[model samples]
Target chain A: MQDSEDYLRKKAFFDSLLTIYGRKPVLEALQDESIPAYKLHLAQSNRDDSVVRAIRDAADKRNIEINLCDRKALSRISRNAKQDQGVALDLALPHYGTADSFLNSLPASFELLALDGITNPQNLGMIIRSACAGGIDGILLPQKGCAQVDPLVIKSSVGTVFKTRILRCKTLHDTLARFREAGTEVIGLSSHAKRTLSDIGGSGCRIFVLGNETHGVSDAVSRISDSSVRIPMQNQVESLNVAVTAALIAFRKQL
Target chain B: MQDSEDYLRKKAFFDSLLTIYGRKPVLEALQDESIPAYKLHLAQSNRDDSVVRAIRDAADKRNIEINLCDRKALSRISRNAKQDQGVALDLALPHYGTADSFLNSLPASFELLALDGITNPQNLGMIIRSACAGGIDGILLPQKGCAQVDPLVIKSSVGTVFKTRILRCKTLHDTLARFREAGTEVIGLSSHAKRTLSDIGGSGCRIFVLGNETHGVSDAVSRISDSSVRIPMQNQVESLNVAVTAALIAFRKQL
Candidate 1:
């Protein structure tokens, strides 16, 4: 039993590690003092160019472990040999946690965003950036049906992917059901809804759910939602971009 | 003098035509009856697939001219041999007009969005989509220092690029100056502004300026602005995404 618990703990730790490749990305990650930096992997064949030198210096300054390995080992570590640029860095995302843990520590009144089947990485990153910058407290990200955190997402977020609190779940429907059971208000966004975004009042633990690009919210997820609100649109517009909708929700309080 | 007038008119007509490539995009354009269809170009080597048949039928229904050309001629027409999928469509943008002409017909107490050096095609497309869907009347598009309308932009706009009223200008600074002279209120969006977006009243013709991705408004443009306002942000985020900012401005009336 003890061995099994140890293995689970190690697995959880490794799961939180995001291995970002490319020389510039690694150097930028090292430069940001707030991002939790782990071990750095460098290909042995990489020449000591200025950027490579800068990455090494930043790593040394942060006291991060530097693993000089062969090209094959570096490729294995990065999993993207063509774009890794002979370097990779594992970052321990301090703000990443599970939904259960996040709910336990939630405040009495909070506004959160839950993404449902957002497949575009750019939209996901922009949503994260807006949620982090605006009045949103946390983001509920599902493991499935959503874009994974990739280099494009990182770029879109302007590196705020490391700064925002992401509560991961196996599936959004199940997690939203649990949140509803726990007395949290789950609101789904739909274009055909009668009520506008301003019609809803902020008074409790609310999770504003944004849906897919082509389709709105999934039927199963919509069934569990407490209410639905639409952003007021003009000019016969059927819908706003998913990321733009997220921004509107994130900054709704300020508005 | 008559020949010169005819030549000028022909040049203007040709300038407004946008030739979009790719099989799916062309078919989608043909299906949307609202879009002004000019001509259709297809490669002779294309097989009679379902999509190609659909495209031909849609063009036939609309009475649009179909130009069947060889592979080399089709490549020259599309300019994207690899991705055009042996099809291209010419669309005459009905809402596209010059800034001077748009200003002459400006409505009283209107809201407008002006792009200043937005380089990313995706960002430009999202901004146009938001501005089109929201309460904004027109978008002042500078001919310089901005991403030109392309297939990626059309994809990002979700076809709204053809619907929105784009007031073209040679440069933003000169046009902004001309608008200021005509008693239009020019508001620049900056993070450090003391006044929030809500602080401004909703009277008179207003043009909100959104700046570049990395930099805020250019110094030359900022100097001529009547005032500036900022979106209220939290969590130490310096600024929102340019497209997000545009959405907020476009939908500010609803808020």
Candidate 2:
């Protein structure tokens, strides 16, 4: 119960930080007074174009700080410098942070989903939409081995990425361990599980772990799960798409 | 029972027709003799490249007829002239025809999903994969206002398009009416339905209807549906992805 109380508290901090990349999105974010812009980063080698000049003028008018950085530094921040058009912005999103911080503020009754190595940005975005739409409490996303949340992801999520409760972590294995320690059942979804999702526990404060598209749950995380469940299938279909599987488990009856 | 028996007999005439576009995919289809190739289409203006030569030779060896037509004619055959690369093939795929032909083959214990106005190829492909994986009897794909089963849709379906049963109809509303007359329940899924999916009837040869991504079910189809069902969501989420909704209902147990 305490674990969930902590998440609800952090949920209050929704849309607290959003790092938007690319020229158009950055400029749009800067122009939209509604979205809080902290700093604007520009590649030092950007060509003198009217759009670039316009972006700078907008930042100046808004009193948003503009930093000139090398391509590498900008790439690290934007994650896609080639497409970034030498522009990026750091905005204050409402609720987003480390898994620990999110867990500390979790609600007493919640359903969380831990994404494990989902490499496709479109799939990741769609999964986030499903999780949010299903009313899943929070999503735990590892920093590595997955597609970085970028413009494409934002577009595919249909802009829901901004509002969804997202908890980032360095590694999911460790996060699953932490979830287990909190007396929350860390359930892993796999095609080989003996029990179906209907037979597994979904109620209470629990986390459902979905793995990579090609590979099922990783061995490391699968080893520590309280129980593993499979979505029932009729054909020897190998498995359904990972995002679709997440939807099934996310929307499954809690009881 | 007699309706399904009629379909089983017609299933023997598999792959009577298929129109596949794109250079690589058409070439691949031509090389694979296992797939019946009825005709090979190429633009008269196409350069006589090595790969094109190779394709001609393969088709010659397979006794498949080749048509060298103008760009417009080839595009008409391929449906996607820009991406077709001047090459297309008409092969025979298993189990695809008008809704009347498909319904004649459906089994007594069967589940069908009718897609209405789902224009995205990726979503259509994903839905077909899920339907096949979950053992759906047939999918009603309208001839209008939806993504056609093109190369992208085939790629997204991961080649399940070859084996999955597909029922093509002129309009979804007409298809729903046919299902109704056949004593099959045409259940349209809506986010605003009074009864949840759990509360509705799902057994005994029911066709679960899904509407467009942006718009829910078409008014015509909705009016003809035996009952409307909603997937219960906890979070004030408006709706799930159309493909994911199909997956949930396609795999929902029949009693």
Candidate 3:
């Protein structure tokens, strides 16, 4: 019983940690007083430049733990040797949490933007930005098929990834099924859907599932969707980018 | 006067050619009979693969010329040595033309999507896909300060770049000025605009100008715009992705 409890505590600690790499991003995170940083990592081989100096100064001022390791160790920690620029930072973002916790914290009537099989980091980041800007209650991002919250995603999101409420799950299909069981309407965007997005109104707890860029919503996920709606294309043109579709869904009410 | 006339003739001839590289894209072009082929280029170092054989077969069936050159020559033709994969094709797209020609061909009460300082190739491609799918009459793409119609853009557009009507301009500011002169309603999107996009209806020839990714609409472009509109954003989120914004504008009628 004690071992199981310790394992759960360790898992929770790792789950709460979000590691972001790159010199400029590390410096920016250090400068931001609101960001709760756990540790600052640097490579011993890093050249002493003004940016590096600023990063060190900021981290010292913030009183964050600093670890100076070899290049290989830094790479292992950052997980992106090429673009990490020999620096990485671990931040415990308050807005990031699991789907269960998010569901427990939600109001009676809320909306969420869920992603399935979205592999492009830039697209994932842009979708997060749209969801945040449009005031979607939470973003349901699967830990499996969807893109990870990497540096590219952070860059494309323009730092909104840190600010947005992200609900993580192991698989989108399973989590969507759970939401449906909880009396939430799971809506998928499809080209062949009979009704348009504007047709969807008077929602209770709702989850909008955006699919892959090419193949679209997986068949298993579609089966569980309460209903489907399309954005209504014209001129015989097929579809919009997945990110654009997410934006349309995010700002559907405003429109 | 004769020398100037020759120069103009040559310029028009070169302007009509759209070159796309990479083996798969070239092979796809060869397969599509609707795409007018000008020439096919291949590198001598290329292995005899099934795709290359299919490309040659398709080109031969279509009576297109094939030039097998050195690696250097192939790279020169493709202009992308790293990703060209030893193949290139020149296509005479019917949908591509200059701003002046596009203006001459415009119908009354039409909508055009104009891009200003959109540097991301992926964003430009997604914008083209949205514009084409949403049935926007024309896309006013300033040749300067915008991502070119490169392989990346073509990939992101998912072949809609060939189908969409593209209006190439030397600069967006100059083209918007000309559109204003022609009594067209030039509208710019901004976060600070007093009006929302839905407020502007019953347009007789409208052009919606989207600005740079970081900066909203440029000052010069804003000066020429008859009016400006904003997309309502919530949750203190500053803006949406440029491509997402384009999709919103493109599909606003349906919304």
Candidate 4:
């Protein structure tokens, strides 16, 4: 019973460190100031010793406990030894602007991205990073059928996930309808659409909905879409990767 | 010296099987019409197994000799357990019509795709597949910077690679010049273009040039481009994955 409790405590500690794997992510978490980090893990055999030293120096300044582990142990925890050169800090997810707060903070006219069933965390992170870069007001992700913001995803996003306002919606269809009612044109991307992305000019506030990798936007979501558009292709290729498709449409809409 | 000669002979046998792997890319070297096998390498343990029976039937019909190796020998030759699957065939690159031939066959006005420096085989395959589905005329891959069509590419293309015309150009600049001479409008996609893809509209025979993933188009290519276009983004996301971006433009051209 005592061992189990210790295990649970370790698990909780690890869970709390999800927000602080990458250098940029950790820095962002630290900037929040209110979020407390208890410990930092540094790999002993990192080739680039500068990053490790900087991390150690920062931890020292923060008065956080530092533990040095072997490369194998760090790899085991990160699940990817290739990129993570063995620096992970225990930190909390920051309480940035909430979805509603961000929306309210945005200018009256703005564009947004709504992701439906994009389960690949790398893809999701890329999409979010793209959305943030494109000046998207916020992102709406389905509560389910979505990859949680994991360490790899945070790395992939280059730390944009920390800054982006991500809202988890119970039902994508209902959420899309809400956008539509709020005077936002909810466009769903489909391969069979008669209209191209260019056909829909960027004249009004818009919300672009990107679908899954295999099965596209659900029928329920499609039914409520103001318009469905497709990216053109040649040479008999059926579809593009979902994240790329989203970037194309999102950028096209902004244009 | 004798062993070296034997190795060369075996290699030659596999090389000779390449011709049978074209188009359908299924086993055609086997003698039996019913059994599907181009070439069969068998282990001693399964001398009378179904796999061996199939190979023998095919070999007998095709009048081809079957090479038998001990399990250890076969394992060494195969390098990986990939050989344990009991069948491995040499698959050929899918046949693509010549650009000139495809152009002559097509109507005067049609859309075309020109890839700048797409190095990923999967991306190339997906681009070809999407291009074919979108009804584009032909694909122009720069001889210098594109991925070669191999077995993996054929599989990824899902057989569409067999139908498309993939022209290998000595120089993309020269090719773009040729397209210009043929009244094909050369458009380059970039992040900083003054004109958006939406502004381009449905025009005459259009040739879209997609660049490398990291760097946009080279200055030389950009200078020769008839029009430079950007896909506008709402957020600050820099770019989309090359294949996905290509699909979007291809679909847009179709629309």
Candidate 5:
């Protein structure tokens, strides 16, 4: 019960952050003091037109620091410099940071969706919404070889990205290794497994490792999984979308 | 057993159709005579650019009928005349037609996905892919409020559009009426139903009704449904994506 309460508080903390991009959107967000503004990024090349100047003035009044970033740096932060309109803002999300921290703080009985090679931003966003709605404990999202967290993902998620329990990691392999060390059974979702989910047959804390759209779970992640289970399906269909599969598992009553 | 055999033959026939759009792509498809071509729609305003000329020439070589349509007519057929580049080709798909006819021919037992007010083409495409992969008997897609079959939907379906069994309806209300008259249980997949899927027990000739992304199953259709069931979800997540819900229901193990 204590862990559940802590999870709610942590989720509330992350949900408060609003990362808005684009000059006009950021300006609007900044002008509204109710909207929390953590850090503002501006392209160094921005000529500070009247609108830009007004943005800087608003930030000055709010005591929000403006970081003039090089083109590459701004693009890195904004993800889409063309649409960023020479500006971006990152609101605070104290609870959403390192996967290691989140995993270490786990209450021992929880469900996690560890993704591998999910490249489409839309799929990533939809997955986040489903995971959050399905009440998964936390999402272990690897930074590399996956779609970067950006505005498109946010749009696709319908703003659920901020509310979802996101635990960022350098790589999922290391996180899975640690979870294994802590005695958590890692299960890879595959359509080919002889055993169906019913075979797992118990109320146990599990990390459901999802994989690429075309390929099943990565070999490295599967190698560490205690076993693999398939969703019993008809129609000779091979598999469901990673996000759909995630929804099914996250909401599975007996899981 | 005979009905199953008939269903297989009907599916095989529908799998042959290939709807190709765009001037360049149509030309390429026409050039490969091995590829099927039912009809070619071309805008009357086409100025015969070298590309347009090539498309016309390729169609000519393939003995494919060319319908010189006005801008409005072309746009209606292509759905997006701007991107269609004044050209669209309809390949043969004899089995995919009126939902009324499909319902009339049902074999007393089947699984169908009856969609209500699904407008997003991507969602429509994804649903088709999942339905096809999960081996649904047929998809009852109403023409009035649902997303029209288009290039975006095709791309999102990853070309599974051709192989899937699609039953087009003039309006979902009328279609639901017909299904009810035929003794098919119209099962609405809502998030609020007291009867979880497990509580519903065995399925028999179920047409799982999937609703809009936001509004959910329309009232008219829900009234017609014999009973409504829900995929028991976790946390407070109200619902899964319409496509994902379809996948869960369409592929649900006893269905």
Candidate 6:
């Protein structure tokens, strides 16, 4: 009973430190001084010897606690049961203002990426990482029909989740309309678009709407788009992966 | 002893089937009707139940043998292993002509994509898929450094690996030189390039070189490039995924 209570208190303490898992992300997170870590969880045995050492060194530098656990326990904590390499970290995610406030805080030339219905956490995580790297002002994801910024999303983001501003909007359509009213040009990426991405010139402020993996942008989003454009494909294969497609659009629009 | 012999025969048959895994390449072989399949593996428990059934029914119509396996076994055979959704066809990959002959066979406005030391099989597979969709005439990969058209590559390609002409050259530099000698403009996509991808004006056959993930194009390959261009990205991000970058280049060139 004492051990169980100790475990519970420890869990709560670790949770408060900021949870980061996966070798690449945790390693990246350690580079930032503002991000504090409470403890490190190293799977009792790990195949990657170098990664294990690196994690230990980082934890040591931060003066953080280290806990060694079984693969099953590590898996349960990391939420990535397939391949954990036996490493996880408790690092705090930086706080950001609300969606409206975050947007208002951006400079005039800033652009934002709005995800309509991207449900894959990996994809969403990657998009967030890419958005942060691309220097977008913030990302606005719909409250419904999208992957939440969960642990899996955080891991795939390579620690960019800590730096990027992600806002969850109640309604994507309404939010997009507000952007339009606020003088932001909204562009929807679609294969069916008659206009090529090159034809639609770049502007100071814009919102690129990325849709679901299979069906693409909803009709409601499409109806409000200032323009719809496509990344011209060879017409032989179906389409590029949603994440890849989103990166192309987001990157190209900034170009 | 009899069971052992049967197992050996099955192993030999599977080895033979493994030879032809790319979708379009395998389709061509199937059209030839010379390649024989002992059995087709299908994940009968996929969410896309109808699609799997349709594929099975089509195979049945072709008088091909069918084998129902669990998703795990099916994943073992697939390259990317993303929810194969109960579908994998045991077909032979067709042989194509040399790069010169393949190039000669193309139309005037054909665009070709070349990869410099892109060893990731998943990226290669997806690039082939996207190339086929983008209507690229052929893909030029370095014989020594690039990923071969393996089963995993085919699976990631969604079968488009077979449909495209894959030219494996001894050296990308030499192949690129030959293309330049043949009056085909060679363009390199690099983050350092001052010219935007949109700035390159061309109406003839074009080849775009995509470098590896970490290192852009090798110095040798970049040296011979007639033009080097960059996809404008927001300053926050360092680079786009190689596959996504390739797709954007393909689409931009197509436009």
Best by DockQ: 1
Instruction: Report fnat, model 6.
Output: 0.51
Q: Model 4, stretches more than 4 Å misplaced?
A: A1-51, A57-86, A89-113, A129-136, A154-164, A169-211, A217-239, A252-255, B1-95, B100-107, B133-135, B151-163, B253-255
Q: Write the per-residue lDDT of candidate 2 for residues B1-255, one digit (tens) a residue.
A: 898887876564443477898877888778766677778998999899998999999999999999999999998988887899999998777666678876686667677889988999999999998888778888989888888898889878876776678888888887788778888888888888897777755458888888998898889888999888888865456777787887777666621
The TM-score of candidate 4 is: 0.62
Report how closely model 5 matches the true complex, as a DockQ value. 0.31
Report the lDDT tens digits of candidate 5 across residue range A1-255: 999999988775655454568776677667877556788888889996998998999999999999998988988877776788888898775446667676667674888888899999889988987787767877888888788667777667655666577888888898889988887889888887887765664466788888898887899888988888888755445666777777767656522
Give me the overall lDDT of model 6: 0.71
- Chain A of candidate 4 compared with the true chain A, TM-score: 0.65
Per-model CA lDDT versus the true structure: 0.88, 0.80, 0.87, 0.66, 0.77, 0.71
Q: Point out the worst 10-residue segment of candidate 2 chain A by lDDT.
A: A9-18
DockQ of 3: 0.59
Candidate 5 stretches greater than 4 Å from native: A1-20, A23-81, A86-89, A231-236, B1-20, B23-89, B191-194, B230-232
Question: What is the C-alpha local distance difference test score of candidate 5?
Answer: 0.77
Which prediction has the highest TM-score against the true structure? 1
**Ten contiguous residues minimizing lDDT sum, candidate 3 chain A:** A98-107
Task: Give the distance in Å from residue B190's predicted Cα in candidate 1 to where it truly belongs.
Answer: 1.8
TM-score of chain B of each: 0.86, 0.84, 0.89, 0.64, 0.79, 0.64
Best prediction by lDDT = 1
The CA lDDT at B55 in model 5 is 83
Considering DockQ, which of the candidate structures 3 and 5 is the better prediction for this target?
Answer: 3
Q: Which ten-residue region of model 5 chain A has the weakest summed lDDT?
A: A246-255
RMSD values, in order shown: 3.7, 6.7, 3.9, 9.8, 7.8, 10.4
Which portions of model 3 miss their true places by more than 4 Å? A1-15, A41-52, A65-87, B1-15, B38-52, B65-88
Model 2 TM-score on a 0 to 1 scale: 0.77
Model 6, A20-51: lDDT tens digits are 57787677667666666666888876865776
User: Backbone clash tally for model 5?
Assistant: 1
Q: Model 4 over residues A53-106: C-alpha lDDT tens digits?
A: 666677778888877889888777556566565666665544222344444544
Question: Residue A208, candidate 1: how far off, in angstroms?
Answer: 1.1
